[model samples]
Target chain A: MKEFQYKNPTRATWAEDYSFLNNDLDNSKLEGDKNKKSNLKVTDLNLYIHQHHILKNVSLEIPDNKITCIIGPSGCGKSTLLKTFNRLIDDTEGIRYDGSIWVDDVDIFDKKTEITDIRKKMGLLSQRPCPLPMSIYDNITFGCKLHGIRNKKRLAEIVEEQLKAVGLWEEVKDRLHAPASKLSIGQQQRLCLARGLAVEPEFILADEATSALDPISSKHIEELFVELKKDYAIILVTHTLRQALRIADHVIFMYLGKVIEAGPADEIFNNPKEELTRKYLEGAFS
Target chain B: MNRILKNKIAAGMMFSLTLASISLVVLIGMGLYLKSAPIFKEHSLWELISSADWQPSSGKFGFLPFIGGTLWITGIAVILALPVALLTSIFLSEHSKPYVKKWIFPALDILAGIPSVVYGVWGILLVVPWVSEVLAPHFVEYATGYSTLSGGIVLGVMILPLLISLFVEIFAAVPRDLRDAALSLGATRWQTSKLVILRKTLPGLLAAVMLAISRAFGETIAVLMVCGNIPLLPHSLFDSCYPLPALIANNYGEMLSVPMYESALMLAAFFLFIVVLIFNTSSRAVIYKLERKFQ
Candidate 1:
């Protein structure tokens, strides 16, 4: 019920600022503010999986406080690109990336970067909901406990706040102590989102978070993401162009592991610059 | 018509096989019960189990000392072996390098395959002498060459390979996505293992430990050689004691010459079988509950 502000300027702002909504129509006006700090900057990114190049030389600046959807067909490196933001791809053996991804003015790929700290700054939702094998309350507070929040009242409040943020509190308010695996697939994904948000991440990196959910649940999640972008930058990887058009403020179309075209959603949809982008948007092939 | 006849034949054969195995166990249990019935008729069950005296000439057939000795030695072995096995399993499943796993796995398999008699010979040559010479003089006063401590140490070593293998398999069976989910939340590797993996596989771990305990309870030659078979309640770890299996192994040959001795020994065997049955059933129950929870 009280307003909360981030003490650190580099952290995502919790208060909703809707000024970006007014400038959504004009692509040139938004692009003119290039001097302003972006949430993330990728420079000459190239990813290789066991000597096979997966992503070609790619560079893009993700604007702050916006929903940027990376849309592409299967095996187009969209998920790989999304994973690189939180360094989840590092878990794969023989994965080599020659690029610099800067988040909050720090190079995440730098040798001196603390991976735990970098991951804490970004929340990740995988394709399927993989809740920790625990009670719902414990799932939400796992990251908080790892970060040294030991107070019971504080933990209970955090569970409520995060679950409410993802619209899971009302549905699961009475069964907070139930096992997370007992929930439906839709509820489990929402609980995963709540668990991710409990860490108070500045960015939400979702890889097909709604692909496994029903249409109603997917609609709820899409609406939640639209509201979330006002406080945190959301970078999503989705194969559905309809979902992208419904939620994405900025869109990047990738083909064969390369970014073909990227700009404001309206501009890319109305006036096509590249033939591949136009064909892909027109449903020639997915 | 031929296919239906074949199917009926196969079904009848499978049913008969199942019945044969169940009847075999029932027949063996009935034989043991009949052999031990004379002792139970002569003395009260409580007195046979709780009385401490074992004077055969005076016709006192107490079994408390053997039961106590078995429990003591098995408890010590479990305490000594469990932590080591858990650590070894965690290393093998999560932390081992590929080359290390390649060598250690076969070595562990070989250890598991070694005969109990070989372990008994090895313990007599090495572990018994070390306990008597080095440990007894320093830690205990007026201790003998054979002790519960020595036997427990040997049994602990014998069960380690089995426990480690079971634990490693359980840890390996944890789904990869569960671990990735934990790590993506910025948890350290140890935290993920302790908080997520361990919790998920707890029932399996318990089953493994129960299996090891059952094996230790029935272990014979290795325990016999080191336990010193004194047929008395041990006052300390350094004191000599006679476990139930050792008592049966040592005195079964003389059963025909003595009256009621054979029946008492049969009763001991029956008691041991019951204990093992309880352990196995509980372990299976835990696994069953775990599977049902997940489903």
Candidate 2:
């Protein structure tokens, strides 16, 4: 796999400074700029399903305006961690969680917190694009309508802006009224991204959003995520190390449902402090 | 050699089964056409269809009154049943808890399995009297204890189980991923149902309603017990009327004594068959379109 060159020259100096650190680096210091508001803060999140611990004492801080990729092998609770951002895990039976996740300084699990409001602040993309069975225009406008955007001109502008953001406007501009199911799988994923962005969410949670797509489509979606990270905080869960390396601004490594290592993407990829992170990144076991 | 003989026997049996079902429909259609031919030959088809008088002894065999009555009863019954069945199905598939579904499903299955005759008796004992004593005098001056409205309400109740079950199946068949996609976008449950689930399952819902309408059209004993079997056009909900099923079921025996009575009865049966055939065919077309759309 090809390594992505860092865009910022200062990041190289920071990586060099952290290169000689022992395996047990202080996690808070490595997170960078503690005074800045974290996009998402997890204090100590422990999740269990029917007495089986799925995630144990996981703590991390996702910086604002960056793509934070959570990478782990199968069944490592990567997807579970992403779902907690939007509270999508609340629907599952026999699941219990201790600790809190705060998004934009608001604890999502607060007793008085409204789930719909929390969900509104985030957009979620699944492994496979699941578009509502409707026209392309309607798919883009569905979230807007739910948020009470009823003006025709505003909806049309939103549709154009969202589709343009995901680079789908030129391809599907002529047939906005066509059924969304008529699109190719790659086009469908882009359309789903457009649909998610239509809500103007402050955060985006993508759970393996490109695994089902072809290589070209995967690249297109990765580029879109990189572009989107400037305005919204994006958290992606991927098992593909190459994908995490290609687009992640920060990388979180998990093993057996524990955060083994987490830091700037270049440092985590070039000089991983934990033995598990090194072995897993060296293609020993995925 | 033994296996070949067994396969041959199996193929022959399957072919015979298919042939038997097709021949049954052919036989009924032929019988209806042949028996009703004399009526059409004696009086012009238009006269029998357009004339209001239906006296058997004097040989007037107009079917206009019965046709009007059939339409009125079936239309009213569908209008009464559709909203109730849809709401019940939505609750069963989406809102109801597991324990609630456990109790409701078996109750509905039992209601569906109950004989239509029991519904007839129940309507006569309960619905008919209630309409007359509670609803009639206040609504109309000359309301009868047995009227078109009573028959419609009875047929509506009788078909509720069929409609509700079909709708439940349709609603449940909507892919879970679609619902998740909508809800994850911050849509309320009602919005998800209306915008996503309802649009996806529309064809199946239409098919269900058409099937229920076909059932209501062919309902016999229950409709007869409550419909008053009056061979006249119903001017109001409180007026007595006769649908085709009740007309045939009530008067088929009289064909043995009266001239041209059997022919008239056979014609009514033929009309009922045609109406049901149209409904079933359209329902099938809708389902086919739905499948093609998905593909």
Query: What pairs collide in candidate 2?
Result: none
Instruction: Output the lDDT of residue A38, model 1.
Output: 39
Error of 2 at B146 (Å): 1.6
**Tens digits of lDDT, candidate 1, A42-143:** 889999988889999888877667888999899999999988888888867678999899997799999999888888878888889998888899999999
Tell me the tens digit of each residue's lDDT in model 2 across B18-104: 999999987988999898989887899888888889899888898998988888988989999999998899888877766788899
State the lDDT of candidate 1 residue by residue for B1-295, as single tens digits: 6999999999999999999998987788888889999987789999999999998767799999999999999999999999999988988887776678889999999999999999988888998888888888887777766889988999999999999999999998988778778877888878888998888988889999999999999999999998899989998999999999999999997755678888999999998988998999988998899856642
Docking quality class, candidate 2: medium
Residues A1-286 of candidate 2: C-alpha lDDT, one tens digit per residue: 2453434331235454344333345454566764443358898999988788999999988766778899989999999888887877875656799999988778988988887777887888899999888889999999999999999999999999999999999999999998899999999999998998899888888999999999999999998998898778899999787788778877899988999999888778777799888888878323
Off by over 4 Å in 2: A1-38, A46-53, A94-96, A255-258, A273-275, A284-286, B2-16, B289-295
Local distance difference test, each candidate? 0.86, 0.86
Q: Score the docking of each candidate (DockQ).
A: 0.45, 0.54
Q: Cα lDDT for residue B127, model 1? A: 86
